[model samples]
Target: MGKIVVSENVSLDGVGQDPTGEEGLRFGGWFGQVGDSDREEWAKVGFAEALGAEALLLGRRSHEWFAARWPSRTGEWADRLNGMPKYVVSSTLADPGWNNSTVLRDDVVSEVRKLKRRVNGKIVVYASGRLVRTLLAHDLVDELRLMIYPFVLGAGDRLFDGIGDRKPLRLVGSRTVGDSLALLTYQPIRDAGA
Candidate 1:
């Protein structure tokens, strides 16, 4: 069975929105606040994750965002990301412009379940906050890999917003990436009685 891993870059205050300043939010571009060394280390971590993942699960906006940038880049990481199977959960998206992309127009939960069954390795999710919340609500996520940046965006959409219930997780790994970033890996405690 495929393990659904939600990998994200979040702020110290749990903000995950507009990290790249693409959305033009007030606190956007928090990702650029860090130094070059920090960013370099973060990129290495991302590359390693992409190398390990069997497939990518994304939302429509993220699909569009990545398709605009990654397709033109030529490198090992870019090649892997562009060639990997990508499933975008989008009802309105007619054509996923990215290579090896599929649009999931049906119920999100059921579609993800089917994907989990079909895929053999890790299905990594990136930059899809709404979809991530849905997966968390339904207990579909097997693990969370959060790269926590040092900045605290006092007002913005957070990573854990709108998650109605208490979803418990156990920290499986923790490390610092460069000088300011914290990489945390957590596994969801699925068994309520455990």
Candidate 2:
């Protein structure tokens, strides 16, 4: 079985919004706040994560965004992402428009549970703030990989907000990427008698 991995680029204050700077949020372009030296390192991390995934789990908006962009990109990372099976969690999206894409129109959590039973690798969820929160709230995420940026955008969308339940995560690993960004991996600490 595979684990549900919630991976995202977050700011110091846990904001996961507009990392690509194209989301049209007020704090769009926050990812560019990082220096140029980290670009290669960031790409390496993204590539490794994408290639390691069994498939992708994304929200409708993110699915559309990636569908519009990644196909035109030419690189190992792009190829991997373009080829991977993408399971989009949405009730309203009829056609995902991305190759090898499927829409989960039923219960998202239950469908993800089935996906976990079916796969033998990782189900990586990236940049879907709403989907991430839903997974976290339901205690469905097994791993949380955060690429922490250097600054705090106090007024943008946050990755860890509005999750009404408590989900304890234990730090599994930590490293510095390019002298500025911090890569943190955490695993959920399961409680007995669930």
Candidate 3:
């Protein structure tokens, strides 16, 4: 089985929303406001993961957003994401224009579970906050890779807002990057009952 890892950039106070006051409390470009060093460092990690994955999983909103942005970025990372298989979870979006994209219109959890069984490599989920919450709730995420920045935006979309229950995770890795962001890697704790 493959892993579903959420790679997101969040503020110190846990806000992951828009900090520029454009989309109300939505964190549309929260990470972009960070310093270049911090941004690049995260990009390095996230892009590496994206390249290593067999496919990219995204929600409808994130699919539209990344489809517009990542395809324009000319780099090895961009090529990987643009060329790799992408599975999008949506009820509305009938078609997506990002190179190798597929819409998953069936039951979310069941579909993801089936995908997990078939993937031979990683499944990276990027910047899908609402989808992240749903995956967490359904035990769909095998791991969570969070790039925690140092600054806190008193208010914005948080990373863990609608999580249903407290899921146990084991920290597999942690590193501080250029005194700005902390890279935290965690895998869900397998329950004894399971």
Question: Highest TM-score: which candidate?
Answer: 1
Which pairs of residues collide in model 2?
Answer: none
lDDT of 1 by residue, 2-50 (tens): 9999999999999999998988998999999999999999999999999
Worst 10 residues of 1 by lDDT: 185-194
Per-residue lDDT of candidate 2, residues 1-194 (tens digit):
98899889999999988887886887778788788878779888889998889999999998999999999999889899999999999999988998999999899889989989988899999888999998998888999999999987888878888998778878999999987999999998897433
Error of 1 at 136 (Å): 0.3
lDDT of 3 by residue, 1-194 (tens): 87897887778888867644456654455656668877677778777787678998998988998898888889888888889999999988877989899999998889899989988778998877888899999988988988887776677668899797898888999998655889889989879454
Local distance difference test, candidate 2: 0.89
How close is every model to the real structure, measured as TM-score? 0.98, 0.95, 0.90
Instruction: State each candidate's clash count.
Output: 0, 0, 3
Clashes of 2: 0
Give me candidate 3's TM-score against the actual structure: 0.90
Overall local distance difference test of candidate 1: 0.95
